[model samples]
Target: MKKLVFIFLTLISTNLLAQRPQTEQGKGSLAFWENLTKLCGKSFEGEMINASENDQFYGKKLVMHVRTCEDGKITIPFHVGDDHSRTWVLTMEEGDVIKLKHDHRHEDGTEDRVTQYGGTSSNTGMSKVQFFPADQETTSLIPYAATNIWWITLDDTTFSYNLRRINNDSSINVKFDLTKEVDTPPTPWGWED
Candidate 1:
C-alpha cells in the first residue's frame, strides 16, 4: 500500500507539472507578430523630422527601400541641409527587430553630412541611439516615450511610416506623416515570391 501511494502521488505531480504553462525561451511568440511577413518587399518614401527645439535641427526628407529575402535590407536615403544626404541601412534582427546603421558616402564616394544616425532597437520597443555633436556633450536620442519609435508598414499599393519622438520632459510628442509612391512595386527577389 505504501509503494502504491507513492507511485500515485508521483503520477499526479508529473501530470500537474505537464499541464502547467511553459515559459517562452525566446523573444515572445509569433502571435505577437501577426501578419509581419507582409512588411517585407515594400518600397517606401518618407521623412525624418527633428522636432527637438533644444537642437537646431529641423525636418529632412527620406526615402526607404525595404527588401525581404533571406537576408533583408532597408535603405533610407536621408536628405539633410541643401544637397547633403546619407543612406541608412536598416537591418532586421532576431525576432523581427531592426538595427539602423549610417552611411554618409554617396555612390561616387563623396562624404555627406549626416550626423548621429545609427541605432538599435531598445528593450522598450524603441530604437535608441546616442548623439555626440562636435560642440555639445553626448546624449541618447530619446523619442517621446515608446510612441516615437517608427516602423515601416506597407501593403500592395501603399506604404507608410509612422515616426514618433519623445521629448526631454517626457510630456510632449513629435510626429511625422510620410507617404510613398503608389505606382511602383519592388522587384521580387530571386528567391522571394
Candidate 2:
C-alpha cells in the first residue's frame, strides 16, 4: 500500500512539473511578463534619447500608459505629444513567448493602413528585457521595416522602448522614468472610453 501511494505521488509531481515551462528562455519570458504586468494602470513620461533632430518624436512629449492587463494580454497606449495614435499590445503565447504588436489608429478611431506591425521574441529573453525581430506580417505591411528589431527593457527605475533598423543602422531609443507615476493619459485613438 505504501509503494502504491508513493508511486502515485511521484506521478502527480512529475506531471505538474511537465506542465511548466522547461527552458530557460521560457522561464525568463514568463518572468518578464509578470514584471510588466505589475505596472498596469500606471503611466510614465518618456524622452527620446537617440532620435535625430528631424525625427518626429524629437522634443515631443511622450507618455506611456499601462492601461490594461488581462490573463494573457497587456495593452499600453503610447501618446506622443497630442497624438494618441499608437498602442502597444503584448500578448503572452504558448511556449512562454510574447508577441508585440503596434496598434495604430486615426483620431476618429479608425485603423491605419500600416497597423498591427510587430514581432515575437525568438527566444526566452532575460527577465528584464526582450528582443523582437520583425515578423512576416511586419515586413508585409512595411517593406522598409523588414530588418527592424524592437526591444523593450524594464527595470525598477526605468523602462525603455527601442528600435534598430539593421539595413540602415538607424535606431530609436526612448526611456521612460518608472520611479515616478505620472497622470494617466487620455484614451488612445480607436479605443472606447
Worst-scoring 10-residue span by lDDT in model 2: 18-27
Residues 19-125 of candidate 2: C-alpha lDDT, one tens digit per residue: 86533425788888888999999999999996788999988899999999999999999999999999999999887889999999999999999999999999878
Candidate closest to the true structure, highest lDDT: 2
Give the C-alpha lDDT of model 1: 0.40
Scored against the true structure, residue 130 in model 1 reaches a CA lDDT of: 18
Clashes of each: 4, 1
Q: Could you tell me how far off, in angstroms, the CA of residue 17 lies in candidate 2 after the best superposition?
A: 15
TM match of model 2 to true structure = 0.86
What lDDT score belongs to each candidate, Candidate 1 first? 0.40, 0.92
